[model samples]
Target: MSLDAADGTESADRLGWAWPDLPPGELGAPSPMFAVRHAEAPLAPLTLPSGDRIRAIARYEDIRTVMAHSATSRNLRYEGAPRVTKGLSIEDDPASMLNMDSPEHTRLRRILSGTFTPRQIEGWRPRVREIAGELVDTVAAASGPVDLVEAFAFPLPSLVICELMGVPAADQSRFRHWTELFLSTGDASAEDRVSAALDFAGYAAELIATHRERPGDDLIDVLVQARDDDDRLTEDELVALVFGLILAGHETTASQITRGALRLLSHPERWAALVDDPGLTPAVVEEILRYDGPGGYGMLRRMTERVELSGGVVEAGEAVFLLLPAGNMDPDVFPEPESFEVTRFDGTGDRAHGPHLSFGHGPHYCLGANLARMELQVAFETLATRLPSLHLAAPATTVPWIGEALIHRPVSVPVSV
Candidate 1:
């Protein structure tokens, strides 16, 4: 039954259901309720906490079609468009690439594309590994049980993104506070969410002004030059890009790193596997992306035109939610879908399965995926090599999760090395 959003209670998206019980039970599993939804409602209607009605697609193939098909568009800026949260969602931002459709989306993405290409991110790998090494060293040197989230996961990406933006290391804690409010859906009021956006954008604006006067060699400086020298993007667009990058660039990856470590450590054998053969780190990374990808429900899109699917027909003006993690759970594509095998993506023998939809397909595919992969690879590899005895100090069920916003992660992963 749909609760009136007018009242205070609202419905949760898919991830909310899975998160309560999500440290991959036994053979690395997805939630039973989540699996049931994949089977029964792979394509069904959904309502956001904002009371916006939309269609949710969970099957592997259907999600790919929605992402690739021309009929489904991400332009959520139209009149009476659906809202993803009670307050201003990324879709509501006119300058955000998340809210724009092609040509405009293409233009904004192109400006930053040169920096995030796989080759470009690879060039930054040495520095990333250096950062990860230092973090793991701290965990190793610690005398007592360490909270991985505090000691390793969170700071690794926070430091990396700060370095990229040329922001002072001192400001990260403030950014983290603003980001939590900005992403809040159920746990925050509309005013609080809006306030967070204003604060975040205001800071970005100040940085833009600073870069204009004296340029530095970082992303913010690059963006400032782009706006001043080439006029490639507007003032608002530049701010939106910087704000989005700062928040999205590291937050999700941090969540993934903590969650991945939790998943491996929960199963001692799995942890040993990675420690035994670091060569398997790549495969383990893919499995983690597939089994327990970060964030709520998934990507949201609007139907610009009606499209037919195996389940039913989606009409124009209707919004479609692509449940990326749910799509990754499809048994038809990934054999014995409930269990998460580290080598599931190995593409060897009967283990050969379809590519995981953790990252959306087509043009809207995650721009920072390569950087994220490298971060995960380096983080885990360093953990295995540096702290081979890393094990959960507490039960997985006891781990605390944070993020009242779109992307939720364990607040702490108590571990002993």
Candidate 2:
């Protein structure tokens, strides 16, 4: 199977529409075509801006297989490895665990995993709760329509991740600017994106230096200590790892917060339901991850061996895109996949509804999932409790959506209390 789609090596009719470029349906749900593809073409080829074609594994089971499969490699360091975009994307960083597989990836993941475990994350609950409450108070007091993205959504996670990583509080505004460009697709130019990313890497290096000078009580300190003690990962890898965490730590969570608030606010009953019962916060957060999670472009991998999927057979050395959002939308796995129900996931934790792949599956599952859930739960609970009358400052239609990106986040989420 040739990957070239630019010179007509692959038939145009077989390709799914170029992704990360498609607009989300109402309220930031995945494109309807993703749901349709689960049945019509579970294994679909998608054309990239580079004109290379990668197979999209759209069904829930197929996606799970790809993600958990040992034979599949996420090694994007190969020459001409399928570029997610035309510029220097996160995938281009070979030192990052995101682009590695097996032992190397496993090692780095373990080093950072201990900090993000459910129990460890729970330890930070008080701080996360405090941050959420303070932000809500600020948003509640602000007159006129508040840009939730600026005032609440982005900041809450930004602060949490920064604090967790031991970033200086004063540098957060500049940090936001770099991350904003790093996450942008069409809004920022390729050169601009590269510059921002480089600047970010430099800043991360400085943080590492600071952590080295005075071993503090944060993740960067832990990583710096790990590197000096055991020679775990190289200095460059250290910087990339920290940089990767900073970007992954908050970008999607911020997006989820923005979309989650908008979704609940759009439906007054749902907002009231959460307001009436704070216990419903966890379930609502899960549903938000299911309905509007940062799984837009999905993960990219190449099969090291031929494998049969729920959809079809994938050949060796071929690139495949695991569509996590589509799997979350799988009607078989999640009944009424289109509906936005807070209680969609029962508290029993049964297999009926599922372990949504929004957080992903297997070895590479999201490291910050626990922390992210904590942030979202606290954010939503705080909002509903503090501002029950919260509604979109403008129309839901007026909410700006940035479509062309690896993840989905609104340009600005506006609201009023």
Candidate 3:
């Protein structure tokens, strides 16, 4: 059944269908439906969890074309543009870089780029390691099976981002709830999402005010002092930026760590290999990202003008969903894409697999890629070393997944050391 038909009426397809489906028994594999769509309809129409119907671009080249094209925009406030969810318009949050286009996005991204540079992120390794170590230590000390998502995965990135922003650790739980609500898709009601956004913005405003007064040695303080050619971020922008960073910075990485551990534990051989050689942790992390990145698709983009693709022309104002997972699994890009081989991304030259779109490409590529990688690497290494005997508390197939979200993650990664 077509996506439109599935959306129009209650049907069996709706139950079995997911925009980016992981077929039964295929944990990290992309749905075979993607391969069919990629070949037969690169720009196939699909319905979002928000019930918004839009064209989905699943082929690697087509997805890249749309992402790299200057005419496509990330801003979703334009009239007639398709939206992921109601009450989640970028217009509602003007300070968010996610809502900006062109000069504005460039300006805001430039102001914040310095903080996430490779060098700066590398310098954060020790602290990230420290955080991961502490979390792993807690897991080790647990009396019984522990949900890694609650114990280690979620808190590691949460604590790191909280420290980076100088947010009190005590308030981490509150921020977690706010971010989950804000980023949720079908799981949350429109009123709930709006409430979460308002609460977060209010918190950010107060935090920014505090930073302005105290001016600590944190990213928040740096942002307060940041200027680009004498141009400074406005109060709204500052609050939005911090709110965006806090939400994006931790949530995605946290999901990755949780899923990565699950991937390793599911594949005992790979887990054993990593335990035998910690150096493979980076490669393992990369493979995990390629296989099961948190996001099902890249940010929604609106076509500013007609753009031709393998399937057909995408007219102006039409929403395009770049299915990142589909692109990452394209056979043309990665040989045997279904196989989760850690060494696939290891070698320097021809041995290395092509880059995956998990972090995205072009202008809006993930700003926190380096930091995310460091956290994932440390997470795997620490888990492999500190809890070499760690295993899933239940069968991998039985683990619950939060499928109704912009980013998919395990509800909880239950494990025992």
lDDT of each: 0.78, 0.79, 0.77
Error of 2 at 337 (Å): 0.4
> Which regions of candidate 3 are displaced past 4 Å?
1-25, 90-92, 227-230, 347-353
Q: Clash number for model 1?
A: 0
Better of 1 and 3 by lDDT: 1
Which candidate, 1 or 2, would have the higher lDDT against the true structure? 2
- What is the Cα-based lDDT of residue 137 in candidate 2? 86
Better of 1 and 3 by TM-score: 3
Which should have the higher lDDT, number 2 or number 3? 2
* Deviation in Å, model 2, residue 207 alpha carbon: 0.8
Write model 1 residue lDDT over 299-340, tens digit each, in one string. 778887888877677788888877787787787888777676
Error of 2 at 228 (Å): 1.0
- Candidate 1, pairs of clashing residues: none
C-alpha TM-scores of all predictions? 0.91, 0.92, 0.91
Q: Pick the candidate with the highest lDDT.
A: 2
lDDT of 1: 0.78
Residue 5, candidate 2: how far off, in angstroms?
19
